[model samples]
Target: MSTPADPGQAEPQFILYLDGEAYEEELRLLATWVHALLLPVYAREVTSAEPWCPRWWEHQEAIARLHGLWLAWQELTDPAAGPSGPALWHRDHLGAVMHELRSPSGPFAGCKQGSHRPKAVPVVEAF
Candidate 1:
């Protein structure tokens, strides 16, 4: 993914599930991407019925899972993956990830449509 760095600056590389100590640069870049690009785009699909957490950044599981999904997206959609890459991404990654993330009992349980924060409710906090 592209970074805020100038074109002359080499972009940082990332791998899924690496040690934070060894991959701080890559981790930061991935976080930036997830927050900046992924969330905004994904938010549009969130309906009141499908709920999503606006404070998803604070949710460790969401971050980790999304990172893994993002990594899979990159690999599965690459040119080298051939003509079926997009189809594979849709079938194998997007469907599963979106279901887990947007399920009624999932990360966004009390959230509403659009860019809303989770509704205040009396429930145990999530990881």
Candidate 2:
């Protein structure tokens, strides 16, 4: 997922996966968009009933899923995707991803409506 040095000069592209090996520039772009765009617009729907992790960056699975969804959103919303793109995104991406990420026992289980901060838990590495 290496970004070209002059990516701005070319067609806009994004990393669809959240691997650590993903380009630093791509990660930065995604992070900015997630913080600046996605959260502010979408997070209002998150509640005690359908919780979402405020510290979603700490969760690798959530990050990967969200990045993929974001990439699909970008692609499907473009004019080049044609009229059916939105339908495909809603059917193939949005519903499932939202369900998983907001499931009661999912990554956001600990998060509540008003208190949305997540405490990071140390990962135990198997060597």
What would the TM-scores of all predictions be? 0.61, 0.64
Local distance difference test, each candidate: 0.66, 0.71
What tens-digit string does per-residue lDDT give for candidate 1 at 1-127?
5332345655434454456665566567667877777767654466756777766655555666777777776666767778898789778887788788888877777666545454354588798
How many clashes (backbone N, Cα, C below 3 Å) per candidate? 0, 0
lDDT: worst 10-residue window of model 2: 1-10
**Taking the tens digit of each residue's C-alpha lDDT, what string does model 2 give over 1-127?**
3223334555445454324655556667668878887777665587767887767766666777877887787778767778998899889998888788888777788877655556457699999
Q: How far off is model 1, as Cα RMSD?
A: 7.1
After superposition, which runs of candidate 1 have C-alpha atoms over 4 Å from their true positions?
1-27, 35-45, 112-127
Clashing pairs in 2: none
Residue 58: error of model 1 in Å?
0.8
The prediction achieving the highest TM-score against the true structure is: 2
